[model samples]
Target: MTRVYTLVNQKGGVGKTTSAINLGAYLGVYGQRVLLVDLDPQANATSCLGIDKRSVRTGMYEVLIGAAPASPHILHNPRYKLSLLPSSPALAGAEVELIEVEHRETRLRDALAPVMDRYDYILIDCPPSLNILTVNGLVSALNGVLVPVQCEYLALEGLGQLTQTIQRVQKSLYRDLKLRGVILTMYDSRTRLSSDVVAEVRKYFPGQVFDSLIPRSVRLAEAPSYGQPISTYAPESHAAQAYDALAREVLVQDGIPTPAFETTR
Candidate 1:
């Protein structure tokens, strides 16, 4: 069974793309075949994986509009040993184009159906805003959503609106849609604000928060510039270890046996 999860959060600059990329890489390191779907029009996830958006003739935009097949858009990230459904700037127009289309919300779900069994996990990196594209991501994720919340002031600001949106989707679209877990990212232990935010989020969600918190690291921020995941860019960094632990937690949550952690050092 493929575990499809949308890394969603309406708030921007919350490490959604970073988490999606590194988490999928670590999952692949743990021997799970992972597919990362870049649903954001910004195409950060696609470019972060070393794929040039300008050179991508076909991507999620083409697939969603029925102009191309999903398989052809799928690109392999050799460094991470994972697959990616690249996104391009043209995807921004898809929101308006899909508005009048029949079953627009499920277009992504339908597009991914043929390749669902080809990977052990399918992770979608959603845009910051809750738009039609984000809705498509939520609809395609049958398993649930993995939220990356940054540890800072106003960290929980838009979470309520996001939860309400998810509830609305669950009520009308996917009943099984769930809040898989909350991932605390860019946590700085030296700052009091970081600790307070983590405590508050844990108090709010309780067991829904993952045990592994991603620490603030320069390597994490720099990895994307090099078009590689933290596992490949700075394997010995704390960010890499945190994501590795996160991969184990994800498997354990799904009742899949977690393998022993192997240091990327």
Candidate 2:
């Protein structure tokens, strides 16, 4: 069975896209047949993978609106078993068109039905909002991981709205949807404020938090612009190693063995 995981957060520049790209890449490097679905219309994930958005003909937008099939849109990367269902800016229109459709939340669910058994994992990189497209992603997710809390001043504020959305989805729709865990990102270990934010998150999330903390690094911020995941672009960077560790933890939590930690970075 394919474990569908959504990397979602309402915050921007919190390393959400970075985590999605590298985690999916390394999971493929670890021998899992992974399919990365970029649900973000920004196409950052697609670009980070070296796939030009302009050349992408069929993507998540077409599939969700019943304009394309699931298989043809898959872009295979030469370096690994990972394939991608890239997204385009057109996906932003889904939020509005979905209003008049029956079972709008189920559109993505139905589109993914046939391909569920073909991969070991399906990673959905959601956009930075709790809109219909995200709802569609949430409806189809088995579990979700959030990249959050870059500081302490406004630690985990406005999270109630997101949790409420998830709770409501579980109550009346996808009862099986689960909050997999939270990974703290962009922590400047030199700051006491970073420490306070982690403490605050742990109080509410408890054992659900990942033990690995992602430090803010220039290498991470620059990797995407070069059209490469941190694992491939700056393999010796701390951010790369952090994501590799994260990939290992995700595997371990799923009852799969953790891969060897990379030390070069």
Candidate 3:
């Protein structure tokens, strides 16, 4: 059984793509068959994976348009057992076109069904919006939805909107959709507000929050520009180390035995 997760957040620049790329990479390194779908029109995940955006003639766009299949568009990552269904700018147009189709929200769900069982985990990198594309992702996933929340004062404010959307989806669509967990990103332990935000978020979300929090680091911001994950771009950076811990913790929670790694919990 494959567990599909979508890294989603209505707010941008909160390290959503960074978590998706690194988590997927580390999951792959940990021996899970992982597939990362770059659903963002910006194609940050594609570029961060060393994929030239311009050279991508077809990818998520075609998959959504029914012009090409996902499995065929997938490109394997050499450093990990993960694969990528890279996206391009063309995905922007698909959002509008998808509206005209029947069961538009289920298009991606239906497209991914035939190939879902092929991997242990499939992570969809949804764009920073609750649009049709995001709806497609939510409808397609099995049980997991990994939300990346920024560690800031107004962090929890926008979460309500996403939760409402999830509620609607559950009521009208995917009943099995699980709130896997929320990973705090750009956490600055130095900021007292960060501490307060965490405490407050935990107060509300409780068990829905992930144990691993991604710290803010310059390396994570630089990785996508250079087409590499933080682990490969700045292996010694704190962000890389944190994502490694995240991967370990995720696997541990799944009851998978890891060789030798201590998660921060």
Among all candidates shown, the one with the greatest TM-score: 1
Off by over 4 Å in 3: 262-265
Error of 1 at 234 (Å): 0.6
lDDT to native, each model: 0.93, 0.80, 0.85
What is the full ranking by TM-score, best candidate first? Answer: 1, 3, 2
lDDT of 2 by residue, 71-175 (tens): 878888867557889988888887787798888888887988888888888988888888888888888887664545555567687678778888888998799
Write down the TM-score for model 1: 0.97
Across 69-162, the per-residue lDDT of candidate 3 in tens digits comes to 7777889877756789899988899999987888888878787888888888889998889999998888876767889989987988778899
Clashing pairs in 3: none
Give the clashing residue pairs of candidate 2, or none.
236-265
Worst lDDT window (10 residues) for model 1? 256-265
lDDT per residue for candidate 1 within 3-91, as digits (tens), equals 99999999998999999999999999988999999999999999998888988889999999888889977998666898999999999
Candidate 1 local accuracy as lDDT?
Answer: 0.93
